[model samples]
Target: MRIQEFLQHHGIATNPFADEDAQTDLVFKTACIRSVYHPAWDKIYGDPSEPATAVVFGEKGSGKTAIRLQIARHLADHNADHPQQQVFVVPYDDLNPFLDRFRERFSARRRRRPDRVLSQWHLWDHIDAILALAVTQLVDRLLGVRDARHPAARDEPLDCTMLDGSQKRDVLLLAVCYDQSTADNRLKRWQQLRRKLGVSVWMSYWDIAVGVAVTAIVLAAIALLGGWNWLLTVWPYVAIAAGWLPCGWRLLKWTWKAWQIARCTRTLRQTIPFLRRMLMRFPAGQLEGQPLPVRAATDDRYAMLDKLQGVLRTLGFAGIVVLVDRVDEPYLVNGSTDLMRALIWPMLDNKLLKHPGLGVKLLLPSDLERLLDREDRDF
Candidate 1:
């Protein structure tokens, strides 16, 4: 009997043991692998009401990615059922962009201890990027639902009225700044925001140039007015003050607004220092301008992380879960133990791990398990 005739006899449509299985997505293929699928599901995706943070470690072909996908699917389904109280999943699995940025930062560390330099690279940029993406997605969806410009939006089952005008503007500004597709205009808008928030206390080049031109014109007018009256020399002194007037007026306006925001958001006994500084520096005042702050590259990463968490809590998300996997992929690691140690150590901070309204599912390679075991203290 031919091979086709033998399979037809057994009522099989195709070869059951074909290598084509390797080409499929692991999440679907692992559905039949009860031993691997069931345990992972029970630990990570079993109960929606019970909050959980877990670390799954396995070798390259051991179905780690499959579990991540399954957890996402489970959460998505849960979200679909309970739209009002949804659990947002922020996937921090893509490591390329962050790794590239991290490499740059690592190279720039000048003659410092490797561990100390690693500590400085405190994962704030990565955390900020994640939350920004989440906030953008949520705000955009809400706006699209309410916008009558789109015919399909009318059918979305969300109560757009839940967000007031100020909150809406705050969210919109965040979306614009976080959007990568936004061009040079993004940086310009960001600078405009810093001025409005009183964070950019210094005068920009454009402001200085405009003021200078105004002062020059004023000096010429005055000199011509007294053309042979011997007043041209004194006009230079007057023009000097006039040049600074435009810049001063703009600074005064910004200062007043910043003071208003700082006064309104101030409170007492804050746990998160980042939130404390942020609330003190730029509070949610008018919400007319961008709500996010632009930090220098050397600022504290922990503060950035805490500030982002506070922002999410303020936005009314009950829980935010960050899924992190593929630790071995970053070029910085390249199978080097020391490099991997530097990369993942800061993520183990006690405060970050124990933060409220946050859960991190870290799926690491089995090779890293050995490094994790060498820890001197309990985590």
Candidate 2:
């Protein structure tokens, strides 16, 4: 007898256990996602009004991904109902891009060793990756850039009018630092977002204009006061070069700052020149005293996350929910339990998991649960 006939004899409509992965399993996607519920469902999925963090560990084929999909589906339903107090869902399962960039940061010899590469991973790197993903998605919504892969992209686009001037600046700043779309022109997309948000970029070009104006004035002074022959002299050129001192100094400062950010944010695939160029597009006054993710500590990242949450709140998001799943699937980890432990241990910090206005759901492998006993009370 065929499997379908055997399942029918048991009074079952279809086979639910036939598929292993929930992402590609048609049966689970159509039926089980709505009806099936784990015993710990209520505990894992707390009140949507005020999100909470939950960490779950299970062996392979234990429905961890299914639970993640269910949470996403339920959150979508909740968002449709409660439009004002919606939770911003950030699916943080994809780790290959981050791991690839992180490995490039090390030497060839060091990159060969998975332990060494993963050992360098810290909570700040994770935070940077999350911020990059979140900011990129928001930019897509604002610009109406559609990607078939992103389910939420088909939904209503974000209302740009809802954001005020400061919030607009915050969104633009976040995009400059973290938007990582390889398909579109980064500068053009940023300019489009700036226009959509009604942000003024005139101030960003003030320094360059000042340098050019000063150079023009110097050349005109030499021609009018000392005759055209003075323009051919070395003194005129010297004065013209001196006129660019302000622009040159600002460029140097921003370049150094970009290098620091690129070096410190090891997981993000950004170069010094690109980051510097993006930084130059922002007005100096707008970026003054801003918390940039250019340090090794988590303090700056937390502050940036707070800024993001505040912006989201103004845009109708009551809170943020980060769903982290598939810890062992990245190429570097390759299903190795030891490397998975190294990659995930840094994110177990209570402070980050319990951060206000944020909910982090880490779906991990069962193997890592054994190492939890060795951790101290602080973890």
Candidate 3:
């Protein structure tokens, strides 16, 4: 029988492979296909921001990414209103092809999303990436739909270009620890955030940006303001200073903020004598901060989560269905194996992301579920 007739004859879904399946390709099919139908996906994972997310954990080759992908496909096909609902959980290795198709959707006037690459240790590694994205978020807040489709052109890129990963993460940590309203003057506030939070790295980057601008101005001025010979020696020094300026500024900015927070924490400790005495039994850092280098495999695991989340908030606002997958056990074990809560807390948070009209489901290994001591709300 012919392939199309064969597929039509069987009630089962078409062959899944892109190349091998003879339906699309054997390896995988575009998620935008129309064969998807659902009965109860609407009941369980249908409502995002509802209450608690459905989380499942599993080991390698456990069909975790697959199940989540299937559910994601269903959500996308059924809910056409919001096109950017997503499926994350593939490794960074697979992201290139995923993004290729996603971009095509944009040209087609449909919403799109690439799979989230779960790199090892990235959950901890994402401070820089998150901050970079946050800066873009600020830009989005300011510019709105004029720049909505092109995330690459905004502050996310500039944010990364200016700060090293470690420095960026420290800044993000401070942002989370503190909150403020940016309803107006987002650019001004976002710019001032580094100073308000005391992020030295931000200062360094800021100065670098200024120095580059100033050097450009100085060179332009040299044509009229002074002799070119002075410009030669001064230019190199200016360039060198301009070069280190951003790094130093970032270092200074974060250092200053860290200092202020430290002072505030210290003052609070001193004045609350009885409370301090009661809290003395608590461990100092493993709870508040667990450095990633100590646990080599514990970085950047969910580096893509914040990106996924930003898209969800956007989709939810637009009245679309957003499906997130491969998020169960979305954390990694780190160096301090001695303590358990560090790893447990993020896992707990991942499990709690459910809200109305939005769904994040997991196809996880049963063994992993046992290891984490959690139950899948859907399963």
* Segments in model 2 whose C-alpha atoms lie over 4 Å from true places: 4-15, 148-154, 226-234
Looking at candidate 1, the ten consecutive residues that score lowest on lDDT are 262-271
Model 3 scores a TM of: 0.33
Query: Model 3, 1-379: lDDT tens per residue?
Result: 8776777788646654324222234243454233433344444444422323555454654444544455545444433443333222111111222223223323332322112122111233222223233334433433342434321122221222334444444434323322222344432543455444333442323555666776666667667776678755756466657766765655554455444332332101112232222122122221244221222232422322343344334433222222233333222221122122232233344423443332334444454455455545743
Better of 1 and 2 by TM-score: 2
lDDT of 1 by residue, 210-300 (tens): 7788767776876778664535367666667777876676566555544443222211111233232222232224433333343433133
lDDT of 1 at 84: 46
* lDDT of candidates 1 onward, in order: 0.53, 0.86, 0.36
Candidates sorted by lDDT, best first: 2, 1, 3
Candidate 2 is scored at a TM of: 0.94
- Say which candidate scores most in TM-score: 2
Locate the minimum summed-lDDT window of 10 residues in model 2: 145-154
RMSD of 1: 9.6
lDDT of 2 by residue, 1-379 (tens): 9989998999988687777889989988887888899899998989888999998999988989999999988888888898889888889999999999999999999988999989999999899999998888888888877661453223878898988888888898888788887768888888889888887777888778887998889868866787788766798787767777878988999999998988888888787887888888788777899988878999999988988998889878889899999989999999998899889989988799899989998899889998897778877
| Model 2 accuracy (lDDT, Cα) | 0.86
Poorest 10 consecutive residues by lDDT, candidate 3: 112-121
Return whichever of 2 and 3 wins on TM-score: 2
